[model samples]
Target: MSENILDIKDLRTSFFVEGNEIKAVDGVTFQVPKGKTLGIVGESGSGKSISALSVLQLIDDPGKIVGGSIRFKDEELTTAKTSRMRNIRGNEISMIFQEPMTSLNPVYTIGQQLREAYKIHQGLGKKEGTKRSIEMLELVGIPSPEKRVDQYPYELSGGMRQRVMIAMALACKPELLIADEPTTALDVTIQAQILELIKNLQEEIGMSVVMITHDLGVVAETCDYVAVMYCGKVVEFADVETLFENPRHPYTVGLLSSLPRHDIDQDELVPIKGNVPAPDEMPSGCRFAPRCPHASAICSELPELETQEDGNDVRCWIYTEQWDGEKGVKVYDNETTS
Candidate 1:
């Protein structure tokens, strides 16, 4: 068996609008090792959520997985039949979507929603499914699971609703779990709790996790490996330790520089200059070259995601021998605005 539970290569998901194609996830590739967490970190419109959605073949009308291989447990997901996908989703793999308030059906009770997974995946009857649902709720640290199960989604607090979402995703003991911005609107204490809960649950279930988030703090706390995405592409991929200690891509460095560090006293956070480009207005060359301070003539041509000697993958011209710029260029100097 392969060590990677999920492997995506050259993924290209796009939305066809009025005579225009918006490449949301363009030529993306990454892997999630079994029993470990991989963090897909980036700002908004980086295609983190789209990539996760493509894994479940959940792209709606006007949007599609146009190209690339999505292999889950060596099974080709892109070509998998609807029936096969139905069996796989929430059975072997499950996802906790971004907003719990909207993700959960308001009409359905918590137990009804949770029970659906058990019923569909395990062939459990209503009584058995309800029993399992309550257990899952309790497992996720939701107090008064028996009572909460019968309550509607709106009845629960934001944190509680988020817990319910987690419970539903884990009801079938899925081999892989994709958590998309699980801590988005929650407070700091709730965020910490949610992250801790996920880590504990991952340890207990022995499931590989793909954590999609913009928060670097969450990545540092939970990720084993990190893939930094920017404007629909992965600019840098490395182990969490290596990524934190030494980020290779200029985009990655800019992201790190934007974060406020307690260890070092800084006057203010260094925000990355310029917003992400529109899908249609994407740069022909390196996507980040427009905002990169080190961009030069070589950067005008796109760079491949090449592997370095240290096993880190970076999609930048600075690491290549063809870099015509000055030798030993420091990416994180205080002077560079970007």
Candidate 2:
């Protein structure tokens, strides 16, 4: 059997707002193995959320997938019609959004929502669905789930609500789980709890997870592999250890250097030189060249993201040209100016 559970190939998603085309996700490619976590980390507007939405075919309104393929369990989802897409949405690929409060139905009781999730996907009888709902609540670490299941969304704490969302997503035992900034809205303590719970659950069930976040600490803690995105493009990708220990791309290095982790001294946080470029007017050449220190004449021509030796990959001319291999050549390591 193939180890890869999800393969996204060169996906490009765009939206038309007032007759203007805004490409939100551009040429993102990555693979997630069964029972492992692949973290997509970048700042806001880097296209992390949009890429996850594209996988589920849920990008609404003016947004649409413009190109490339999304393969789940060897099935192509890129061009699948709405009717067929419905069969896969929550059944095969479940998603947990960043804001569980807004995502949950505030008007409905928690039991009603969870039972609907179970009934819709599993086609269980009312009593069976109710039973399963309680089990799900318990699974997500909600205490006294039997009682909590009957409570409304407003009655539960923020952490509990997020847990409910995860429970609903897990009700069908989906082969893959897509979590979009799952902890951004929660407090520090709750964030740790939610992340820990997700990791533990993935370990027990052997489900592939695509955890999307801007938090490098979260990626370092849970993800086995990671893709660093910037301005709708994946600038670097490699296993978690390799990415943190030896980031190859300038953008990736900038992101790692700026992380608010203790290993990186508080005074040593080197912020990226420029803001995330807007989608409408992206820079030519390397999308990051204006802010890249190692950028030279060659940087005026875009570099392709290609596989390096030992299964690592990067999209910077530094790796393509000058690295002798003892240490990665980081252009933005100190966030210098040319």
Candidate 3:
């Protein structure tokens, strides 16, 4: 098998609202290695969800993937026909949306929705589909699979509902699974269980996963590699360990510093300095320049994503040879900018 299951390059998804084009995903690039989980993480509105939507071609009206390429198992999804895409979605590639309540049809029973995928993809009979649906529920650790299959989504608890969503996504044995905040509204314990279940299922099925979330804890626990996005662009891309241990970009550093750690007690939780820039009012140069403490006049020009000697990519002037910080780059080390 090839090393990469999904390859996305310079993906730009735009929305035309009130005659102004808003670039929700701007020049984002990354790849999902076969059978490995890649976590796309950032604060909400940083285009994390838009990047995932662009992959499955699920962007609604006014928003469309306008540039770049999404290659899944060597096939270019950008130019793939709608018919082909329809066939691919839920069969070869499936997505678990953020909210199970909103994504699932309240009118339909759990079994009905789960069977839909098997029927459409494999042309399974009603009886076989029902059997497989129950099996999926069991695989995802939902208790009393047979009983749950006959029940509606509203009848199940939040955690159970999330498991049902996972079961539905994995019913057809998709080669790739895109989970958009799988644990969103669930309590902390339930969140851990859902994440563990996904990890266990991925190992058993040997499927590549794209976990889109804002929680760094989730990324550390579930992802092998991570892509950090800010203002519709990827600011950092590295393995989970490298990212946690030695983050390069100022934005990434800020995110790590803000995370609450039990190992060290702090007076209060550190927060990122400013809100993400509005799409219409994006900075002319570096999108994060206004908030980056290490930013200098050279930041007036956008810095391209460049590979460092450590095998990670960062988009910041601090890593460049042209860095002109008065305190040198040492201040960024072991020091919180906030």
> How many times do residue backbones clash in model 1?
0
Q: Give per-residue CA lDDT, model 2, range 1-338, as digits (tens).
A: 56789988899999999989888888888989889999998888889999998998989989999999988877889988888888888888899987788789988999999888878878988899999888777766778989998889999988789888988888877889999988776678767777777777787878889999878878888899999898888889899988877678878878877766533445566687877777666887788988876667777777788899969778877777643333554444332321
| Candidate ordering by TM-score (highest first) | 1, 3, 2
- Name the regions of candidate 2 deviating beyond 4 angstroms: 119-132, 138-146, 157-159, 262-267, 322-338
Winner by lDDT between candidate 3 and candidate 1: 1
Candidate that scores best on lDDT: 1
Over 4 Å off in model 3, which ranges? Answer: 118-132, 138-145, 157-159, 260-267, 331-338
Clashes of each: 0, 0, 0
Cα misplacement distance, residue 220 of candidate 3 (Å):
0.8
**Pairs of residues clashing in candidate 2:** none
lDDT of each: 0.88, 0.82, 0.85
Candidate 1 lDDT, 1-338, residue by residue in tens? 88899999999999999989999999999989999999999898899999999999999989999999999988999999999998888889989988777779999999898888788778999999999888878776788999999999989998899888887887777899999988776777767777887788789989889999877778888999999999889999999988877788999988887865433455667788998998878899999988998888988799999999998899999999999886899886544423
Candidate 1 residues lying further than 4 Å off, grouped into runs, are: 118-135, 138-144, 260-267, 333-338
For each candidate, C-alpha RMSD in Å?
2.8, 3.7, 2.7
